[model samples]
Target: MKHNMFCFQCEQTAGCTGCTGRAGVCGKQANTANLQDALTGALIALARTIQGKQTVSAKISKQIIDGLFTTVTNVNFNDVTIQQRIDAIHRELPAGTADYDMKKVWDAQEDIRSLKSLILFGIRGMAAYAYHAMILGYTDAQLDAFFVKALCAVGEDTWGMDELLPIVLEVGEKNLACMALLDKANTETYGIPEPTTVPLTVEKGPFIVVTGHDLYDLKCLLEQTKDKGVAVYTHGEMLPAHGYPELKKYPHLKGNFGTAWQNQQKEFDNIPAPILFTTNCLMPPRPSYADRVFTTEVVSYPEMVHIDEARDFTPVIEKALELGGYAEDQPFTGINGGHTVTTGFGHGAILRAADQIVDAVKSGAIRHFFLVGGCDGARPGRNYYTEFVKQTPPDTVVLTLACGKYRFNDLDLGTIGGLPRLMDVGQCNDAYGAIQVAVALAKAFDCGVNELPLSMVLSWYEQKAVCILLTLLYLGIQNIRLGPTLPAFLSPNVLQFLVEHYHIAPISTPEEDLKAILGE
Candidate 1:
């Protein structure tokens, strides 16, 4: 039978290949997958139309960014919202615009599909960063212009690797700029994040659980609910909110409610609190707490309460009060059974202690740096991350971010050079911060970033990780370790090219990879 849909973008693809049946591994329905495909085709159509114009305006840029981000894995599963996006894109076209069938790209030669997938998925990740910055009143003309260029390139049939390869690296280059813009917007608005300890327990009282990576939305919710009886807790990617100075000051902004995004269906089911989704990583809601789930910004689902541009969170707030939370304090611990986690070791915080870190390395007090970070998912192979961190040498430092940190964030790794051994940089967008720290260390040691005794051990579940990986490659950083499995879209030839040029390796056991990385 012909496939109902095709998606292989995230880490949890079925059978280590694309999902091509009635439903995706993440529980996305076939129709939802079809709409996502249609939305992407429409974005490509919109890009083709925009290419003919003399100047691509900011309004057009926003539309392209919005459309791209909405189709990312676990972002939007609502047919109504996606169709509305399709209609809106159609409205923007001058005339005679038709969506380029995504099947064409999917059916292309394996190498071609690999390159194009890189372009398409890279931009999808970049779009999330651009959207976050735009919400905070920051926009880059160059960054916006590239969206039009990249989308148009994805639609071009005659282009080969010679034509598409540079664009892939450019996606990395532009993503760095986009990440910087988002980092600037966040730190300037919320104040630089500091090392803050966040409890996993949910305090007794009416409470709201806010998830996703949008800190601005969380800040707004904190403002509106201030002086009210409701308490607010961060979930998943929002866990880093506790480290921001401005956000942590809120008395009612209590702590994190659950672990990563994949566990939400079980964690939030019939819970006493309401949950708000500010951006992506939204699973299709379970019937138990579907009504209590609210969405805003680019996140949407049918029948769920959506907080619109007005940002009025009254509906979500009222639901929190109605639930009235638990009768008493409920203690929750991380996967490691620890009651608290530490975060907010952002670039600034890390750099401020640069001298101590440098001295530690010089004195052999710190042997190496392992960046064990990225998104988390449901697959059993993901346990590799927990084991890897557990097996790291005591003298090594671990820097992590994004939802993946939840795997072992609660573990007490002890101190290195007066700084916590494991430092939590903000969100995935804060990969810029991680880059900054790496560059500074390289400079301090008079060497290249890859030459600074630092290695990247990354786990990816979504497009955001794709873009970050591309950025590292663009910077000519080498010997990176990626797992639990390689992307299915990369055919043999393209995979060979990456292996020869970048030395990228599929991860093995914690002991083996650690020995290899440390040159044992």
Candidate 2:
């Protein structure tokens, strides 16, 4: 177990195990990973100090969130910035508190390590949601307090599975609340998303492609470049922004740029536009396009221009105008070669059609529903998602969200009754909506959600998907199918507990899985 460093927070960890060498599978160097660990330890120290306080300022809470979120996979690879955050955490800590060693958890007994990793990674994911909601002027005291409480638990030396299991499940409870706060902030600020059809063509002009999940950053960029003749295109999780009415209002907000985050290195190689990364899903830029990269908010790399709190996007705009974009409209297709893809099927849109959907279900026109979504990565076996969706019966509907949808989003699966067979359910945070719709459908059916013929076949990449899975487990929903791989952090006993209690299974082939799911 001796190594330079240890990391297994992402689905694509080296060799389906911990990345314990010079670099992680996501290109995060050992130095950066160590710094991240140090920063996380400092946050835990700060949390241990603040957990007993009656009043903690919003500023301090935000710092705790920033510290936790920076360690999430693919978020911050800038060692200097990571160190700066760690120093800030040290400055804020009271005199006697010492930084917790993260290796303690990584080196703990198997079952204890597994449960604690769930709590730590789960809150790392929750912090991203809290950060987003905070950006929109929304804050919840319970969510804020839970961050400190959970971090304190992660830092504790005496807590075993008996003490940690409740906190692990509480991460799900609080994350459910956190997602609700973010959903409110998003819907209120940007308006509820409507079904939007986004093109794959980049119009012939100066355009900037914004990736990652931060919609507020996109809003800021849209405002700053409104009359500058720069068109903005969505990439990865930002694709869901197009469904929000306030965002699509910008006339120059053009079509989508590339596919999922995994394809960026290849897809972005030759694009004649500057790309702005607002959040996660950042790959190390290639030399051909590295200079064209700009980051804002928490997403940072060494050489990229970091847009600060002032929210000015002038440098990004100038880069786009300098590139001048394509001489003619360059049409790009998704992996499936479709010329266009559509999104914006939030819970609102789906629930609005609930009566009709229920009628279709009762009448046997829609036999079942499948929710197949989560993060997408460069790892193999992802084709399982594509093939699984393709093999689903025509009588079933596929509701998807997150970047995982990009694998099959462009494929037109025709329609059941009046609704499209393939429905894009917005971004990763919109898992709240997926849960909402399921609960509503279950209520209407007079049964539990797991009894509604809905199957959750998820593909996970990082901590955000980890929290979502935790939320699903918290609700006691069973029979979820996950792939292309199970997490490396889940110990044999912990994973076995899940399989026996929740019936969670690693995905088999689409042919066999389809047969089993359909009870053929």
Candidate 3:
């Protein structure tokens, strides 16, 4: 088929293959997708050039990180913005080396292609965490250096599993450090998140729904809208905002809005209030709700109002007032018809209750722990997650995050050992919290995280998920079941490597996978 471009990097790719027409299933124009690929190629070339150089400045490194992350699915949907970033990267190079062709890496041997994809995609995800940490004044040299090393490895041909395996693990290892940096930044800036309950119903009157994965933006919005008669509610990945002491202190920071990222199109339809997107997972806006959609920081959509560095949110406030919302307190519920959703079960909160959790485990009150979380997408088979969570034994603890939780978050899974079996652990970025809890559990049992009676059933749809997966691999955590399907970008050889090294498997039906996971 003669197509305008190729874009299969996401779950919504056209025809279950690469998007080769005028626009992607993700609504990304062909030109924009190609430009993203070009930006990524330029980054690889820059990394290749600086592979052995020990004198690269932090400014150059930051540009490389930002440029790669900007190309990630749903991050930068605007061609003009991506081009500007490409030019910025070119300007940073020493002006002597030829630009590396990205198509070469994409067209390499299946094995090499797969290995490189892991390193590349893993770094793309890591950059997001690093960017978030950077915004909070946290930076790590080791974490920054890995991006360069991993990028250079993607362009290297001498690597096989024996050589690339460590790099793959390194992505996970470095991502852990990156996540830690972000954790420190977030906790230091917003205070440790405590257990918090966020309602699903939107309070009547003027209110703004803040989506995306940035806490600082949410904090800024809460600060700006204070005393303005405008209420702020978390949406999508922002559901965790209620946990942070600094953010929750705001009296007007109301409950969550909508569900997962994929459902935004339908959920936001005719929504009276303005919605501000602060990061990735933004879908193309529908006309009915387009006027109310706003972008801030790196998230940009055509024709949407964008709040700049000034961080002024007056436009959002005005729109909220204009919308007026519902005249009465409109009651809303989650997919499972629950009127409330609970979040903020972060590491600090979980570990504080560690004694209870350990006692439960020792008494056999909590038999198995399942961390069922990841990005949510439009794929049809993704219902497997909700079904999987539903099928979990009553004695199991279900810890979830990202948009994936929306599939089953509303379900009343009841409790085990005085803790809600289904625990919402904040957003995808808060995967750091899940890691902390797992580590604490292992420490309590005096075993490795993998050795604990814990399992991670993850579903990934974008780069941020990739970084978290890498962090998991880095810690040598094994027996993770990931699905609804593996990325087509992964070659068979690379798949074999992951299976042999980490015992990662594709998800099956809930019943079958559950038996396998539980050794039934």
Candidate 4:
């Protein structure tokens, strides 16, 4: 079937196949999605051509990575902006080379299609982390080259489990490096995060809620709103901002406003504050609150206020003032009934007390470790996350990230050696933190991360989660339980490959999955 556009790359694709008609489930027009695919094809060709070149410049590499990343779901929802990226990639490549048709990969055999999808979606997700790392002045050669390698691999016709297996793990491996680079950038530019309790109450008066995964944007917003009588509250992934010393230092920076991204439609309705979305996980806006939603740095929604390069947040600030927020201080609680949440358990903070953690584990004070986290969405069965956390043994510790934790983050799970049973390791991007913690524990215990009694139970709702999953797989981490629903985009063969090789399983009932996770 001929498609004007191919959009099976996201979880919300039309009818569970490629969205070929006028628009995608994401509301992206056919022309815009086609432009994005063409841009991706051009990038793949450029990457393939540069694969063997030793002289590829950082500028070219950055453009390729950023271009692919910008095309991800809900990221670049504008046709004009996507075309600009296409033009930029075209300029980077030497003339006369034919661009690979990205649709060809999408239309390949189910198995080959699945493997390639992992590479493509994995990189798209990794690009977000790489982009964040670049903003903070961190880059790794392996990470950059992997982008080229993965893109080139997607264009290759050779398809075997061996050929595909390495690349699949490579996606995971490169993602780890990319995430590490981002972690370094974030921690150095900001600082190692410490445990911080964030309130859900929006202090009365004017305030802005910044969402998405960009710290730089949050920093910019915090800087611009300083002393403006406007309180800044975090939403979605931005909830972790409360953990950073630099960001939390702002007295006007109040607390978090909403829960996960999927709930924004109901949550943001009648909300009397402006929201600045700096990156992914943006849902289609409801008309009632659409005017109050603002986009910046590649996150675009049709008619919302778009904050441009000058980083001037004048309009967002104005909206906050105009909305005037609640009549007085309003108290909000998480889904699990807790009035507050805590975050900032980056690797540095966790490792700082490594000796204690090791001792606790050895003395049977801390038993199993469950990394329960990922992107949260509107899927009906997602409450598995809440149940997963609730079912964790009392002697176990849970590490979480992204907005998924809103399902259970509020629960008072008590503590292990002075550390809360639940540790919020920052945003989804902060999966790097969880990985770092795992690696450190492995080193301390003299075993691979896979053998460190750590099990990952992840729930993915978008491309960012895909990249993080690839990273975990690349690190040879095994037996991860992923749910609430497998990506509709993954072909059956590819799903089989993941299951056979990585032992990755889909989530079943919470009780059954919990027993299996505990090796019962």
What RMSD, rounded to one decimal, does every model reach?
Answer: 1.3, 1.4, 2.0, 2.3
Which of candidates 1 and 4 is the stronger one according to lDDT? 1
- Candidates 3 and 4 compared by TM-score, better number: 3
Per-candidate Cα lDDT values, in order, are 0.91, 0.91, 0.85, 0.83
Candidate 3: residue 189 lDDT (0-100): 96
Q: lDDT tens digits, residues 235-333, model 4?
A: 888888777888888888788887888788899897898888898777788888888989987777666778986899999998888989888988898
Model 2 / residue 512 / CA error / Å: 1.1
Cα lDDT, model 3, residue 249? 95
TM-score ranking of the models: 2, 1, 3, 4
Backbone clash pairs for candidate 4 read 172-470
The segments of candidate 2 whose C-alpha lies over 4 angstroms from its true place after superposition are 1-3
lDDT of 3 by residue, 1-520 (tens): 3337776667556665577888888888888888888888788878887777765678977887788778778877877778888888788778786666767777777777767777788888889888888877788877767788888887776676678767877888888888888889999999988878788888889999888888998888888888999988888888888989999999999898888888889999999999998888888999999999999877777678888978998889999999998788988898888998888888888888999999999999999999999999888899999899999999899999888999998898898898899888887878888988988899999998989999999998987787788888777789999988788777777778779999999998999999988999
Q: Which stretches of model 3 miss by more than 4 angstroms?
A: 1-3, 157-162
226-295, model 2: which lDDT tens digit per residue?
8899999999999999999999999999889989999999989967899999988888999999999998
C-alpha TM-score for every candidate: 0.98, 0.98, 0.95, 0.94
lDDT of 1 by residue, 340-366 (tens): 999999999999999999999999999
